[model samples]
Target: MTTQHRTIAFIGAGNMTQSIVGGMVASGYPADAIFVSNPSPGKLEKIAAELGVHTSQDNAEVANKADVIVLAVKPQLMADVCAALREQVAHLADKLIVTIAAGIRISKYRQYLGDDIRMIRVMPNTPSLVGKGMSGLVADDRVDDSDKSFITTAFDGVGATLWVSDEDELDILGAVAGSGPAYFFEFMASLQKAAVALGFDRDKARQMVQQTALGAAEMAIHSELELEDLRKQVTSKGGSTAKGIEQYQAYDIDKISADAVKAAVKRNQEMAELF
Candidate 1:
């Protein structure tokens, strides 16, 4: 189905959902066709006022009116939310269900919603709030090409997307891209702290790190060279950049980073087990 013809319902009105809705609105999706539901009126009203989408407190209301339902609720609340809409969802065969809550598998969704429901799990990073999200999508067997394509197109407004045939990769992506932003934040925080200790003002230090990060990311995105090659291009033999690299190596940055990501993967796996 075409995007313009689809009535998409967001089951929650959190930051990620707001970002997706904002991106959709910016990308020219019909605001009136988008429906957002939240138990609290504050967020729903804000989304409606800001994005011009329809809002409701009832999950079944949005499910009944939408052709596509996005489960944007927190991972812990997913089971109860699904149970609330189980009857309404069971009756809607034409609807497509897409979830952004990490760690919850498609089989788990099937168990909650039903085996016949078409569902897709997506791991999207926090950068999506700024219209630069990287999402890994995995669809159940019941989701056809048309459904997948439409869902992909809808998320494309927020940022880049990749369709993964393997469900395991989606969980793995939760560690990588999903939690990747936190790693960068930690790194930048260190940079800012160091700059402050070196006598730079906090705001100036922040601006420096933020701008450098933005420029570096843009370069990585647009440059033809590989990331390591880009790093090599900036680091001359026995130069200041090389000295910094030596310190990083001395601190075992690579191993530390890998361990951190692995820890996140373990936590994600644990969530799957918990939920």
Candidate 2:
């Protein structure tokens, strides 16, 4: 909450950028301490009005003012953005650059900046908008302990943070943890609609589906039992649970779920290669 030493900047003033800015403000950082900017006046106005941070249409201005620069733009624009501001960013040699853009590797950032600059790449999901996100962080060798501490607090405002030895694992997680929420949301919606078709009230059906999802997640988190063990425990012979599991197994549900995640991981890897 004590952000007297903070001067954070976000390069793209989009939804995810505002979410992190909101978290920083909520954590006691002065609203004035954050800065966000985009090429569009509309986006700058929207993000600035919402968070009361300084906003500009210039990336270099934001970079000059920030102690930590957050790059939230689409991955396709990263190289151009870097090249555009490369000369102006030499002053940021003492600062840390945190990037939340997916598939943009830290190695790529190193190629853009001077050897003196420190860089870290993070994979954060949209759930951070509700303060329940997951972020995986991996830093370049140039980063110092002080920089890590600051970055830890910066990301902690969003949700849980996991630091990994090899960020390769995160490319897969960008599928499971990053793009994963949508998959489950779709599954829940399907279940709720099925319940409604079976004559349950819409609101009641939704509540049932929500609770079932929450309970299953809690079981996975709190118990030492493996997921398969928990599934086996609930599935007694010839019961409804067993019947559902049997149906799922009969249709090769496991393979289907795996294929979904694999497809995502593969695409993410391909994107990483391109950049």
Candidate 3:
């Protein structure tokens, strides 16, 4: 089915679901074709009012009407959510199941939903809230090209979408693009703190750090140069920028970053086991 004609339902009305819905509406996807449900009416009411989409409190009622169902609940809550919908499993046979929850693997979903379901696992970060998110997707072998195309189009509304050959790669990507925003935020926060220590007011420090970060990101996006080349362009030999780079190198920043990403990947694997 054409993406525009597909009725999409988000099973949870959380921030990520809202972000995706907002992006779709902004991108001119028909809001009327979108349906959202949550146990609580607060978020559903707000989204329906703001975005002109259908809202409901019943998962099966929402799922029954969708060509695509986004499983957007928390990882820990996923099993219970799927179990509740067991009665609807037969009806959902032909629907495309897309999950944004982390850690839980496709095998677990097969156990809960059914082995024959066409499923896709997506890992999207918090940046999706602002339409700058990156999502990694991996689908079951049963998924067809048409379904993949539709899923890509749906997620592309929020940001970029990458299709991986294996679920393990998606987990690694979760460690990078998924947890990456927090890593950048932590660095930005540290810079803000240092600016404050250097006598700038807290608000000024924040503004400086944020704008600098934004500018740097914009530059990287627009430039064809490799990141190392871009850094070299900023760091004239023996200059202040070079000195700052030297300090980062002295502190083994590369190793710190590598280890941090490794830790995140490890935790993702651990969560899969836990769930």
Which sections of candidate 3 miss by over 4 Å?
none
lDDT of each: 0.88, 0.84, 0.91
Q: Write the per-residue lDDT of candidate 2 for residues 125-229, one digit (tens) a residue.
A: 888888888888888777777777777777788997887766788887788889988998988998999999989999999999999998998789899998999
Alpha carbon lDDT at 191, candidate 3: 96
Clashing pairs in model 2, backbone N/Cα/C closer than 3 A: none
Structure candidate 1, residue pairs in collision: none
**Residue-level lDDT for 226 in candidate 2:** 88
TM-score of 3: 0.97
lDDT: the better of candidates 1 and 2: 1
Tens digit per residue, CA lDDT, model 3, 1-275: 56567999899999999999998888889998999999999999999999999999999888888999999999889999998876764467789899999999999998998877889999988888888889999998999898898888888988999999988899899999999998999999999998898899999999989999999999999999999899999999978899898989999998999999899989989899987
- Model 2 regions more than 4 Å off: 1-4, 196-204, 222-225
Best by TM-score: 3
Worst ten-residue run, lDDT, model 1?
Answer: 86-95
* TM-score of each prediction: 0.94, 0.87, 0.97
Query: How many residue pairs clash (N, CA or C atoms closer than 3 angstroms) in each of the candidate models, in the order given?
Result: 0, 0, 0
